[model samples]
Target: MKIGILTSGGDCPGLNAIIRGVCKPAIQHYGMEVWGIQSGFRGLVDDNVVPLEEKVLSGLLNSAGTVLGTSRDMPFKRRFSASSEDKPSMMMKTIKKHGFDCIVCIGGNGTQDTAYQLSKLGVNVVTIPKTIDNDVEGTDVCYGFDSAVSIATDAIDRLHSTASAHQRVMVIEVMGHNAGWIALYSGMAGGGDIILIPELGYNIHNVGSKIIERLKQGKPYSIVVVAEGIKTMENKKAAQFIAEEIEYETGFETRETVLGYIQRGGIPTAYDRNLATRMGGFAAQLIEGKQYGQMVSLNGSTIMPVPLEKIAGKARLVNEDNDLIIQGKRMGICFG
Candidate 1:
């Protein structure tokens, strides 16, 4: 079998590890030919590809970012073009020209939706979810989540010393547009005084009260961890808005730190590398079994295939009643 693989959407730490995981087994064990598609679906539309030899997959397990490259390009999405060009049709042509039996798409939510569309067009498709947000549906956890949470947690831990020395309220923001897994996990792990997630709405007054309460309890410093997508003023960023509001309400010095793309960079954590390897190997196994139109998903300790239709266009979001939240609240950690 000839399989074509591509990475899509935002780049993260575990991408190269998963690519290596897929290519190594498919080449050495299954005796299948593997091809690397460059720059996500754009590569398919543009017919940009290269043969993946065993040597090409070496030393990638600890690498950050993808060697195959990636993009936010969605061929299935409608584009207002002057020329009469159909991207999806062009992609199908490339698939047929290459004689690919199955295309293994490694990406997050948008990539899953596109893979499903390709399957509808009769192209064999299998996917592995890769996102630091941990929002891709039909999977208990995605590969890059562990790496990102580790980075964010480290950042929060470093801020603790400075916050204490200056006796200031430090507001740190982590990535999570539609979900709050990063902020919630890192905040609790890093011992944040207040945690704010997009899943639960927070009041400025409540945030202020939490800071004031911490001060009254002989805690001169406070750490506020917030998700980037948390509700704020129309044109302001979450951390900046919250920091300004906290300073205004309590008359305390407050500062903001946005841990933007830093959370998505660097070598993947050991947990993430293992998860990516498991997911990638499982995806190849599914292809070997001719289980097309499925995505490799992590369900507890097991890696299994989930139908593409079940997860396309869906996202796994943090809930208000998450166990960590309940435990944090019980421990008198404010959630605002």
Candidate 2:
């Protein structure tokens, strides 16, 4: 059997591990020919591919990023003329020419949507969930979340000493576009006094009063962690708004730090590598069973396949009554 593989959307730390996991077993056990598609759907539409040899798969388990490259390009764009075929048709033409029995996509929500579209177009496709935000619906935890949470937690940990010495309110911004998993987990682990997420918008008065209460309790400094996707009424950045409001309300010096691309880079954590490996192997198993139009996900300790339609275009958000939020409240961590 012939199979094609691609990684799409934002790059993650465990992509290489997933590729290695998929390539080795598929080649050795299934005797399948794996083709690496470059630059996501754009490469498929353009017919840019190379064979994924076993030698190329060696020593990639610890490496970060993807070897086949990635992009956010969608295949359904109407790039051609009215009389000509659409981009998805062109991609299908390429698939037919190469005779790929199945295509494997390793990416986040958007990538899953693309795979579902392709499946609807009569292409056999499989997906593996991968996002640092941990917002994919079918999986309990995505591969890159642990690595990103570790990075964010370490950054918050390092900021504590400086914040204490200067007696300042430090506003640390983390990346979580729609979900609060990253901010919630990291804040809880890093001892953030105030945590704000997109799911539960924050109140400026409450945030300021919390800081003031901390000051009254003889705490020299406080840390506020905010998700980047959080919005203010006036469309201001959440971290900047928090800092400005607290400084004005409590007369405390405040500073904001945005951990932009730092969370997206770096080596994979051990958990991420293992998760990626398991998901990748499971994807191969789905292909072996001829289970198309499905996505491989981690459901607790078990790896399983879920329908692409069930997970595509849907985000798993943190509930207000989530155990983490409840524990945070119990531990005296305010979610403002």
Candidate 3:
């Protein structure tokens, strides 16, 4: 059997690891020919592909980013065009031209949705979820989540010494647009004094009061971890808004740090590399068994297959009753 693979959506650590996982097993164990598709679905439409042999798959387990490249292009979405260009049909032609029996899509939520669309079109499809947000549905955790959390946690840990020395409130922002997994996990792991996430709405007054209370309790410095998706007045960034509000209301010197893309780049942690390898190997297994239209997922401690339809548009979000949040509250860490 011949299989094609592509990475889609925002690039993150563990992408190359997953690709290696898929290619190595499919090439050696299953005796399947593997094709690497460049720049996600756009590559499929443009017929940009290369053969994946065992030698090219080596040394990728510790690498960051994708060797096949990635893009955010949605071929299933309608493009307002004057030309008669049907992207999905063009992708089908490419698949047939290469005689690919199945296409393995490795990406986040958007890529899963696109894979589902292709499956409905009678194309064989399998997916592996990869995202730093950890919001992909039907999975306990995505591949890049642990790596990103490690990076964010390290940043927060480093900021503590500076915050204490300067006697200031330091606000650090981590990525998470629709989910707060990164901020929540990093905040708790890094000992953030106050954690604000989109899942649990925060009030500026409450945030200010928390800093003031800390100061009154002889705690001269505080750490505030903010999710980037958190709503802020005047459309300011979450960390900047929280820092400005803390200084304005509590008269404390405040500083903001946006970790940004740094968290998404770099070699993946050992845990993430293992998770990616497991998910990718499972995807190849599913394809070998002719179980198409499925996505490789981690349920608890097990790596398994989930129907693509079930995972397409859904998201796993942090709830108010989460044990971490409850523990943070008990520890006098303000949620606001």
Candidate 3 per-residue lDDT over residues 22-90, each given as its tens digit: 888888899999999999999998999999889998899998889999999999896538658789988
lDDT digits (tens) for residues 1-336 of candidate 2: 999999998987768998988888899888999999999888888899999988999999998889999999977644766647778888898899999999999888889999999999899998888889999999899879999999999999999999999999999999998999999999999999999999998778888888888888999799999999998658777778778888888899999999988998978999988887888888888899999999997787999889998878899999999999998899888898
Q: For residues 1-336, what per-residue lDDT tens digits would candidate 1 score against the true structure?
A: 999999999988869999998888888888999999999999999999999999988899998889999999988886539647789988988999999999999999999999999999999999999999999999999889999999999999999999999999999999998799999999999999899999897988998998898899999999999999999886799999999999999999999999999998999999988887788888889888999999998888989889999889889999878999999999988887
TM-score of each: 0.99, 0.97, 0.98
Weakest 10 consecutive residues, lDDT, candidate 3?
Answer: 76-85
lDDT for residue 14 in candidate 2, whole number 0-100? 63
- After superposing candidate 2, which stretches have Cα over 4 Å from the reference? 81-83
Clashing pairs in 1: none
Candidate 1 local Cα displacement, residue 247, angstroms = 0.4
Clashing residue pairs for model 3:
none
Error of 2 at 253 (Å): 0.3
